[model samples]
Target: MTIGVNCGHTLHGAGSGAEGLFREAEHTRLVGQALVDLLKEAGIYVADCTIDKADTCQEYLAKVVSFANREDLDWFISIHFNASASHKGKGVEIYTYKGKQYPQAKAICEEMAKLGFENRGVKEGSGLYVIRKTRAKAMLVEVCFCDNQQDVDTYYKIGAARAVSQIIFNSICGQCRQGENEKSPGRVQEKSKEQTTFMEFVGAIARKDWKERRIMLPSVVTAQAIKESAWGTSELACKANALFGIKENGWKGRIYIKEAIEQKPDGSYYKVDDTRWRAYDNWEQSILDHNNYIATRSTDGGRSLRYGAVIGCCDPELVCWYLQRCGYATSITYAESLMKDYVVKYDLTVYDKP
Candidate 1:
């Protein structure tokens, strides 16, 4: 089946980057190209509707349907990063017209969410031109909230766009037989339950750096670390020596506070305990515990578990595996984008000392 990918209006360089809105059209263009490559790799035909980028939702979306209809494609998929009036809201949402084919739209949404994103729930669009006008089965996928920093830092920055494309490619065409045929035996091996500690787990997979590790670990432990420690400034990392953030369900641990405040509905500022966190004995244990979490969760699981399982077999690439495994990230492309940034930000290649 042929798939047309539309990068939302942000690509037309409409929004001002200074306002933090229209800054990523260039990146969105890259995202569109990435989707084309991914779809092609899956033995499917791809059309880029985002060519030359449009300014508004209406203009960009018009190009999307025009390209799809022109190609007589099977379906059109519009890729968009979402934003909310309130920054607290984040996650993935898919929209379809009110018709018999809504199930397929939901399937696409659910499959993408399998990357561990919050499900904003699928909705029926009314006036949205792409949803209303596309002759082929179409869905507008909002990968995550662009306005939310945590989502941006975690998923959007990490490559949620590409992750969503892979999911879309998988959902529309099924597993790419070539990818299946290309699977290398023993590419992914389960760790023994005994080696459940965090440091040992990372050390065990040390040969697999971010490049090699995305295939093995699927995603680096950075997300887990940031999620657990509130971006390294947490007491768990600064005080307790816990570099990898691993929160357990029923473990005895200390709680520390950093210091922050919150505004109440009454319009009063309250010294809401700024620093509340879990403490571990040391960083090594934290790393081991993190591994335990991945092993148990086993990426891209749930009703879409089969999809994740297939990717584990076929793509063996850690970031892809992680996307399939986690399947619920707010930013569908979180890990991949993050790895790109990590390599640039930390000069991580220098750390590869023998």
Candidate 2:
């Protein structure tokens, strides 16, 4: 059966997020991309309805709904991360439009809980923009909280992105003996078992130096590194060890020049001249620079007073919002996008505490 997979929110524009330990947009993209790949591999006709840009939240939601409706797909799934002001909220929740629970939604949530997340159960999402507007059977999956450490650990430990993808694939394809479906159940169980050691190793390394610094939240630092450096895959990150994209404002060290996007006076973005970004000797150095960058910005000229509002803030959503207000980035929804798309979805905040 054909289905429309929407990664929920714009990849780079307005109405893009709700942040926590990681940005919602990034996590949704990662999971949505993986879901699409898995579905395609299983020979299901899939339409990727992710929006690259839109002027407003309404426009963005409309565009996604329109795309799915226009395709006349059998089902639509919007992937998202859940967030709460408390930062203690945890688990997986699925929302279908007002009345009844769709079997698919229930099934997806049940399968997701198999990955060790709390099953928050299916609920009626009456006023939700996307849930109410879509023509086909649509469900929004709030995978887990970005701010909860235990949830974050579980997300990585179970490989939620791939696991969710496999669940969707199995739900749609049923018990058919196709190549993609063969031994799927066993494989998912195997992946869950194998991911533990790797998850702990990665978490320990990411948390080590950040814990020593005791400056910004380690989850926030790691989230920014993942977003800015494309998880160490960007040219600046790999070649120069510049994980946080620190610019050469007054740096005396080596610099790397690259074309970068700049927002203009009229809110339009343009490619400016090759910008000089700070180059570090190693990944740890880059992390140290990131810490110093925020610390200096907060303390320089009484700026620390303003930064103090969010310093040691455990809420990823609040942390990101304050960072944006402090002019950390140009995007208006940068914080929300980060919290919703990356932090919460990927459980990046696990690094925040220990």
Best by lDDT: 2
Worst 10 residues of 2 by lDDT: 185-194
TM-score of each: 0.46, 0.50
| Model 1: per-residue Cα lDDT at residue 217 | 38
lDDT of 2 by residue, 1-354 (tens): 678988877756697787777778877876776676456433356666777579999899889988888877788889898888898999989888884677777777787787788899889886898789888888888989977888888887887576666676666556333343354522322223223343343345557755666557666676677566655545687678887787886688999997565444433333445799999888777877777777665435663554664565667778888888877777555686567545664566776665
Prediction RMSDs, each to the true structure: 19.4, 15.1
**What's the lDDT for candidate 1?**
0.51
lDDT of each: 0.51, 0.71
What is the clash count for each candidate, in the order shown?
39, 25
Cα lDDT tens digits for candidate 1, 69-186: 8876777777667766777777777777763346556666676566657777777664678878888777777766767777676665445555655566666666543244256322
Candidate 1 ranges beyond 4 A from true positions: 10-24, 53-59, 99-104, 156-159, 176-354
